[model samples]
Target: MAKQSSNRATQVIEAVGSFLRRCIGSILSAGPIPKHIAFIMDGNRRYAKKQNLEEGAGHRFGYSTLMNMLKYCYELDVKYVTIYAFSIENFKRRPEEVQSTMQLIQEKIEGLIEKESIVNRYGVRVHFIGNLKLLSKPVQLAAERAMNATWHNSKAVLSICIAYTSTDEIVNAVEESCKEKQKGNEKLLDEIGEGPLIDVADVEKHMYMAVAPDPDIIIRTSGETRLSNFLLWQSARSLLYSPGVLWPEIGFWHLVRAVLDFQKNYAYTEKKSKES
Candidate 1:
């Protein structure tokens, strides 16, 4: 009983710390804010193990954290937010884990369409960027519904990557371009054979995120420095922030710190370029 009480107290203390950090961060943020931000929410299972919680519980906590982070981003007047929710590589995990993740995604998509969700309240547009064919029928339907429901919103956009892979997206775009060219360039198609030949611009035009501008900042939690195949094309000029905190433990302060770091670096680079 004493140990359980101790654990409960720790949880309460951590929650309070998170609240305080957010309040402080909001006060400290005074410079130009990023218009777009992307997140690679990593280390869910590790967070679960560290907290002595179930695997699903960690993902649930991550969902809550994402909601809170979005609120903070909205407060900062960020117009675009993208999250790497699931990767094509993640399908290699245990079947049970993948199933649970699918269910969670479906729930989140449905929740986004709810009357009280941020999508409706703040006129936030929701988009899913990935291979929809890989998702379960219900989850895919939910994603489509969420996108359609908020398609007209102009205030903010939230993009969730589900079964997304930068390489796969590039390959798919090339294939699409080839098919389009085949119909129009019959003589060229006959001369060049069946190879998929597409320019970088052609692929960019077909990417799932074609409408959104490249992310200004990309934040990866759990101290992961690698891109892990997220947004290869769009992140070329993006400022990266790697915080040691796990996804379930991330809060607004971490984001604020990343933005400040970006501001400092951007100013330095701008001044150096002008001098040159």
Candidate 2:
């Protein structure tokens, strides 16, 4: 009887704590919110192991957390949200885990297509950036479908990076630029007499995110401090937020705090030429 009472008390306390956190987050300062926010969702496997749960369960919970975070961002009027869903290096993990993750991705994509989910309701355009050919046919098809479905959306954008590496992305952009240049002018190479002189603007025009602005803030959960080869071209001037919470454990309050911190630190300087 005493043990039962103790368990009930603990549940009540947890409920109270969650309510308070949400209330605090909602009431937090109205400040300058980032126009674009990128996230490195990390530590799903570690979270699973710690909870003695299956790896699949951990990933499922992580997806739920992502959904909640998206809603929070929408409420805050953030124009763009990008997430590192999978990396090119992650393909080396055990076959079973890799398969499981692929399955999860398929499920999430299919889910987005049905009914009026947040993505549909909010008119959030979806973009996938990566070596898409490396993914299975179904996954690729789903990604294309999602992008098409949300193509008309103007309110917000969501970019998912799967099978992606910063170096690969840069190289791909450069190759594209070279091809375009060759197409534009057959004799331009001789005219310039250049030894591989590529301008930053030329490369930027060929990148996957050429249509979108660079992220104002990049947040990585699970205490990871490094960029881990995500967004190499675009994050040169981004504000990074590394929080200790695991991806699945992150909540609205955490996001609120990150944005608040960003507001405190952000600076905007007018260019001298622009000033004149």
Candidate 3:
């Protein structure tokens, strides 16, 4: 009798929690929603240490958290979602760790090719933005295949920054733009006829993330306070949000808080963006 009573209470609590979540989601449905949301998923290793689990297992759990967050963002009508999946500097880590991370990423990328993968389920067009040549051939192939497979989806976009850094992206953009100019005009001079040579727009045009608008909110987890070279140029008017929760511990309520915060600051962000 006692066990049955406890189970009944558990059911009631779960039902109440679900109702509250739905109610909150409905309330915010009418408010301003951020079009682009970027995440710097941190603290996988720390979470693993705290939980007494293996390092790789923490990252796997983090991946699941990311997917759940993506679903919440999509439900709220967010059009673009970008994640700092891997940085170019990450290669400097120990060989075993780097290889493990790469393998995990590669597996997830290839998984998107499955018929009922999350990419298809959410109609998300995946963009693996970064220095692709720096990745292994198999990883490159998987990334390419994932992008191609999801190219037809237009409802949403999921841009993963794999093997990427803002500095590398900027340098590549400038080099590519200069090369294009020289090829077309057959001259090494920086100036074009009507323009003052390479300017901000020119560099931005060649940027890896040019396809998507700048992120309205840049979120860093695990209480990190720095941008860490992620989306440096595109974050001029973005509202920075840092919740003390680790990546694997992030929940819908955390996202709800972020959206609420964005609602309160939307006007200022808009005003600032216009001035810039």
Candidate 4:
């Protein structure tokens, strides 16, 4: 009887919360909404230590928070969402820790393609953005499968950056662009004494993030102000928002606050973007 009452109360609370969110979302919809938002999900280990849980448990909790954030972003009609899931530098962590994280990532990535998962629920097309060759064979296969599975959905896009860093992405893009230009004319530059200059367009076209527009807002949790090599090339004119809460503890209100802040400074952001 006690358990039944608790369940009833929980259901009531959830219903009320859902209604409140809808009301808030509608009000916010009246103003400018970002077309793309990027997240540097930080502080999983710190959160786990604070809560007296295993480090891996923090990542698990963080993944749950990520799913909730995705639902909220899609509900707000944001067309593109990007997450800094793993960085190239992260591979240098302790061997056991890296293995654990890889295992967890593999499991969750596989789950994302399920019929009832959020990717399908919102018609989000998934793209794994980064140096995918650095990933293990199983992980690479899983990522390829996810992308293939969601190839038909067109409502929105979810870009997951794994084994990614801004410097590496830039170098790879430049190299690929050069290679394309040099193809079938390997001696054109030598013979003509000049070659076409590689412009911003050329580099950008070859970027892993070329599928999505530049992010309007970049949010880094755990009160971090640094970009941490997440999207240096793409964030030249993006608004940066940092909330004090850790990744796992980030809630709906934090997202609301970020969006509100973005709206408040829309004019300034727009002007800066234009000037860029």
Candidate 5:
């Protein structure tokens, strides 16, 4: 009897929460909805330390928070979501710590392609962005499998940037653009007209992040305002939101607040994006 009562109470609470979210969603729909949002998921380690949990527990919790955020974004009809999952600089960490995080990432990535996973539920196409060659072979294979498994979906996009930094991406794009010029591609020659100079379009075509539009808003948790080498080129016009809460502690309200802030600055952001 006690178990039955507990289950009933849980169901009731969930039902009430769902209704409240729908109400907020309706209100948000009245304004301009952002087409893309990016996240710097910082402070997972800090969260773990704060909670006095084991070494990786913070990331595990952060992953759960990410799933919930994804669900919220999809429900709001936001079409593109990108996350700064890992950076090239992170490889300098202690070998054991790096290995543990990689294992956790591999395990979760495999789960994403399962039949009932949220990616399938929302028809989200998964993209593994950045220099994937830098990742360990097993992790790279897992990422490739996830991308292949979800490529057919069209409802939305989820770009996970691993082994990525904006500066590196920029350099890679420039090098690829130069290589094309060196190949004496007739189209490139005509565009530049007798100089080795490459145009913005030439460079952008080779960017790792060319898969999606530039983000409308970037939310960095743990109250960080700096971009931290993440999406520097793409964020010329994006609104930045820094909430004091840690990534694992972030909830639906944080997302709602971010969107509201974006809407408030919609005019300025839209104007700047066009200028760029």
Candidate 6:
């Protein structure tokens, strides 16, 4: 009898918490919503250690949190979301761990390909933005398939940065720009250049994230104060929010607080940009 009562009480608390979050979210939508939001989901490993779970369990838990977060963002009418899923630096970890992460990524990508998946239900266009060549061929294929499947979803856009690093992205843009210059019309180039000119415009045109504007707010979990090579160029004017909680532990309240913080300072942040 006592066990049943305890279980019922816990369920009631969870229900109340979810209700409050929805109410807060409704209020937040009244203001100007951020067009793009980037996330650095950190501290999965620490959470695993804290919980004394299997090494990879934290990442699994983080995945659920991420899925929920995505739903919340779309519900708030956020148009673009970029998540740092795998960094180039992650390859240095143990091979087994890297393989495990890749496997999980593959599973999630495949999940989105389901006919009734969230991507379809929410009208989210999915994009994988990074040096995809570094990913295993099967994973690459899965990613391409997912992107193709949701290419027409116009309500929201989800960009997953995997096997990526800012420095590598910059280098790739430069390389691609050079190739384009080589293929340019020589007669047209003669007036201004012996060789085709490659400027910031050229590079910007080739950047991986050229599909979306820069993020307005960047939230890094686990209280990490540094950018850590995530979205270096695109985050120039973004307000950084670091919450002191692990990735797996992030929930509706954390998102609400981040958005509220952003709303509190939106005017000033925009004004500073114009003055500069």
- Quick one: best TM-score, which candidate? 4
Report the C-alpha displacement of residue 206, candidate 5, in angstroms: 1.0
lDDT of 2 by residue, 14-80 (tens): 7886676556545653566688899999988888988999768888989999988898787778889
Model 1 agreement with the true structure over 217-242: per-residue lDDT tens digits? 99999999999999998887788999
In model 2, what is the error at residue 140, expressed in angstroms? 0.4
TM-score of 5: 0.94
Model 4 CA deviation exceeding 4 Å by range: 1-5, 190-196
Candidate with better lDDT, 4 vs 6: 4
Please give the range of 10 consecutive residues that has the lowest summed lDDT in model 6: 187-196
* Clash pairs detected, candidate 5: none
Worst 10 residues of 3 by lDDT: 187-196
Q: Rate the local accuracy (lDDT) of all candidates.
A: 0.87, 0.84, 0.90, 0.94, 0.94, 0.90
Model 2 bad stretches (over 4 Å): 1-30, 194-197, 268-276
Evaluate model 1: give its lDDT: 0.87
What digit string (tens of lDDT, one per residue) describes model 5 on residues 130-163?
8999999999999999999999999999999999
Candidate 3 pairs with clashing backbones: none
**Candidate 2 local lDDT, residue 187:** 89
Q: Assess the local accuracy of residue 164 in candidate 5 as a C-alpha lDDT between 0 and 100.
A: 97
Q: What is the lDDT of candidate 3?
A: 0.90
